[model samples]
Target: MATQTAAERREDARQRYNAYVATCPSRKLLDTLSDKWVSLALTALAGGPLRYSELARTIAGVSQKMLTQTLRTMERDGLVSRAVTPSVPVRVDYRLTPLGEDLMPLLEAIKRWAEIHMEDVEAAREAYDRCSDSEP
Candidate 1:
């Protein structure tokens, strides 16, 4: 048999992973997706490129520091790209890279699902709290 290429070997290894396992590498990707800021930021950039201030505005309630942190992490993961335009005081823009855009649909769907079920979630939380308080 012919030797497997590096890409093929990596793909084969990835195919063997089960995210349900605690030590699986796929767990890291799940953890990243679990971040609220990441999902919001990705959804905002889903439309197109945006400036730092614009992203902050679009994703209401996100503090500057938090937005910076989120954007940096996204960029680090190859999900977003930051561009600086040297004009006047210098303008910076953030946009979803192709990979980020590819993930937008799923993110948007998840956001919608959360919004639609928020009332049910709140009710569940209240019920859970009542049950816990009564037990202890």
Candidate 2:
């Protein structure tokens, strides 16, 4: 029997975890990425770094509490960095980290696909509802 190198062991561990499995830690990350606020925030931040108020405005219906919570979570997850500048009123800004930048393309593609296919999805929903209604 041969001992696995550190790199090989890390790769093996990564391969062992599947999101479909209930206990896989990756599911937690999927939950975060799938969040509506997170998706919107990521999309908005892709343009550039933004102040907290700017993010709130750009995302429309997100409440202050929710936005704050989401930003904190993103920061903890290493997906974003927050900087606070001391002044009379103070200034705070949020920006994507390198890991977050790597994730943006995937999220952007998902956003684009949803926008492009929304009509089709709506039509499918209507058809489904109509069929469901006629069933009984």
Candidate 3:
């Protein structure tokens, strides 16, 4: 078999990337949004702007470092905005941007689906647990 040329390899990579993006556009977005801290942060900000400490308090089980990183990533993606106040204490606030607002309905739908199907999910989990217990 003949070896592929550099141009051919590049084209192949591009095609594969395009295919992956087309099939899983929401996968990437979901990966980001599904993160516990990110989801909680978005939910909290759904109401309005909040200070960093306020977010930290609202989102239980999130470490300060993880919250900071999640906020930074969201801000970089243009999903959230950060405002800084020039004061003696240097206050900072975070709020959802229009792009982030667009995700609200999607999140709400997911929440609804989860609520509706929770019993089914629980039953599946219990069945899996029983099968696993029986196997081993």
Candidate 4:
């Protein structure tokens, strides 16, 4: 057997990936958006640009550190853009990039689904807890 070149190996891996596969690259993206902070941040940005404090305020219960981390990751992924204005008191803002805007509708659907199913989700959680408590 012959050793495959790096490019050939990459192409083979790419061909093998399907979203349904556990090792698919897309899984990492899904994981990123699965974080509560990341989804909420994207949802908040869907409205328009907002400063750090504004996002923090709009997303209830998100800590400053976590919010900052989420924003950094989104920015790195090209999902959001950060602008820092030079001034005596510098102003920094974040907004969805074109790519992010393109992805927003699907994410919005996920958000809405959660909202529509909140009662069902809560009931399921309660039932699970009750059953677990009864376990030996």
Name the top lDDT candidate.
2
- Please estimate how well model 1 matches the true structure, expressed as its whole-model Cα lDDT: 0.91
Candidate 1, position 109, lDDT: 91
The true-versus-predicted C-alpha distance at residue 106 of model 2, in Å, is 0.3
Quote model 2's TM-score. Answer: 0.91
Q: Write the per-residue lDDT of candidate 2 for residues 2-74, one digit (tens) a residue.
A: 9999999999888887888899988999999999999999889999899999999999999999999999989
Runs of candidate 1 exceeding 4 Å displacement: 1-11, 15-17, 21-23
TM-score of each: 0.84, 0.91, 0.74, 0.81
> Model 3: clashing residue pairs?
none
Q: Relative to the true structure, how large is the alpha-carbon lDDT of every model? A: 0.91, 0.94, 0.87, 0.94
Tens digit per residue, CA lDDT, model 1, 20-119: 8898977887888789999999998888899998999999899999999999989989899999999988999999999888888888999999999999
Q: Please list the residue runs of candidate 3 whose C-alpha ends up more than 4 Å from where it truly belongs after superposition.
A: 1-28
Write model 4 residue lDDT over 27-52, tens digit each, in one string.
88888988889999999999999999
Least lDDT summed over 10 consecutive residues: which range in candidate 2? 12-21
Order of candidate numbers by TM-score, starting with the best: 2, 1, 4, 3
Candidate 2 displacement at residue 32 in angstroms: 0.5
lDDT tens digits by residue: candidate 3, 9-57: 9997777656257585555766788887787788889999999999999
What residue runs in model 4 are displaced by over 4 Å at the alpha carbon?
A: 1-16, 20-23
Q: Is candidate 3 or 4 superior in TM-score?
A: 4
